[model samples]
Target: MDFDKLRESCRKISMPPEMKSRIKTNCKAANADEKQRSRTDGRLVAVCVCCILLLLGIGLTYSGIFERKLPAASDRADASKAENENKFAEILSTAKLTADRIFETTRANIDETEMSSKTQTQSQQSTESTVPEQTTEFVTNPFVFPNGEHAANTGSDDLSYVRPLYLEMSNRENLIIAKEAAETMSQEDFDLFLAENQSMLQGGYFHSMNAGEYLEFTQREWYIPVAPEDMAEICWMYYEPTHEKIDLGMDFSETSKIRFDINETYKADYYYKDSNKYRYEKTIQRDNATIKIYSRRWLYRFENFAWKGYRMDITVCGQEMSAITTEMPLEELEKYLEMIDFVTIKDWLS
Candidate 1:
């Protein structure tokens, strides 16, 4: 058959309504398939969109740009890190505070210990000082009595009780009269001679020829206030004239130029083997604001039996302070006297 005739024959063979219905059914099925395909394409697009959003969220979480619900282990690790950091900071702070406190306490303790040691040392020293030393013996000078009275000399060998001598020097005044009076007396006659002539010498005159006379006469004589007349007599009795006059002496020419600051002067009564009364001198000094007082006594001896002394005191409240004493031969004593303008005269009236 020809191709057109073959197609006509096939169209004639089909059943009419049933075949049409089946055809419609088939067309419907095709349309449904097409709609299904479009819906499937839309669903595929939605699924892709959901996948992209999920991927973006995952990326953000990985980069720490979004909060995430952490697994238990991750949460524990983060918490542990914070705890360790806090612990480290707490330890450092506690250590710093403790070190500061320890340092301060240690410093305070050292200071307290040093102070305690010093105080203990001072107390120990004070305790040691309270006891008197057995080796030290204080022998008070008998002449330097607390009551201001001097002890009398009994001619005993103990001369420690003998008083010291005090003198002041200045320009000459009425010393000529004293010089004349002192020259006239002999060792035996000194007491009477001094008794009569002591009035001629007004300033602190004592008749004696002991070592002190040579000491004083040869050195110098200065004007001092007169003591009691009995004191003068006692001194004259104790001092006797020598067999030969030692010409070595100095003049008391400076008596008027010198000044005096008298602190204290005293006399002590004494007795001898022959019952002749005698006396000794004592002087004392006191301290003032700007000056110190000094005390001394005139001591002279004609013989072992005859001895005499007079008290003298000087103060330097506004002046200088110096003391000197020495022993020399009779020749030197005479020369010292002559140098000081003390001239020996024979005639009492002249």
Candidate 2:
């Protein structure tokens, strides 16, 4: 049949209304029944899964698969002990800090007390020091000092403690007097003597080790290098009152122009402004002895007078000696030092 004819034939083919309704009702009821059956099956599967999981969990529990080993009693005790020790250490640390603080406080108090005591002692000492000590008079050189008091001769060192006591007792005006007194010498005679007898003279100050002129105070007046009672260079001062040359080191002094102690062991230096005015220092080995040479370009004070020059120091025969003079040339000074009888003096010392 043709498509148009076939389509007309299909349109004529209609179902009964009751039969179509019955078919639709049957389809809806079947869909509802299928949905109900699906819901019941899902509920049954869920219940079966829950029962299987519960049984599996119980079986695992009975087989001991999830069991853990219990810690030993000793381990538990150790843990408890460690905790107690930690707490005890913490308490001890706190106590230590408290003790440290107490110690520091006590130490500070002790320091304050010591400081107070020291201050009181110092104050008392200062007050006592302000008061003058009693001074005795000089019997021999009474007229020399203003207060008729002179320093006691402590040793063989020249002017040991003399200049300081003079300075202490004397005023500035007396410094000028000191300068004048120091310079009261026959310069012409000194020059002539240095020129002539310098090489001949030895043994510090004595001319020939001959003891002369028995003076009071167990001192013999021997050959003096320079003259006129007030002047001194190398001097032989002390001797037995018997005019006996019993020992070589009766008393000897070596004075020079520049300021330095012989060995600088004694405070005999005429004070100078500074050591900063130094020129140079030198060392020389001569006659089995070390000679130290110190030269300064600045002035040195002899009482109030200022002088400057070269200084040479040497220790020989257990005696400190030096020569510092512009009065004589270096060559002459060296010769003068060389001529000193240190070898014989060493024997005397022995």
Give stretches of model 1 more than 4 Å off. 1-20, 31-39, 54-105, 113-350
On TM-score, the leading prediction is 2
Q: Please write out the lDDT profile of model 2 over residues 1-350, one tens digit for every residue.
A: 49999899899989999999999999999999999999999999999999999999999999878877657868965765555455435534544553354335435544554455445445656776432221111111111222333211221222222211000112223323322332453433332332232222211221112223221111111132221111222223232333322221223222221111111111121112333543346666556555555442321212111112334445564455433323234454355444434443233223
**Residues 1-350, candidate 1, lDDT per residue (tens digit)?**
59899898887885789889999999999999999999999999999999999999889878876656576876766765555455434534543553354335434544454455445445645777532222111111112222344232233323343322213232122344444433553322432332333222322233232223431332112222222222223322112233332111111112111111112112222222222233333233234212121111223221111112222222344343322121222233234323221011111001
The lDDT, on a scale of 0 to 1, for candidate 1 is 0.34
lDDT score for candidate 2 against the true structure: 0.36
Q: Any residue pairs clashing in model 2, and if so which? A: none
TM-scores across all candidates?
Answer: 0.16, 0.19
Deviation (Å) of 291 in candidate 2: 93
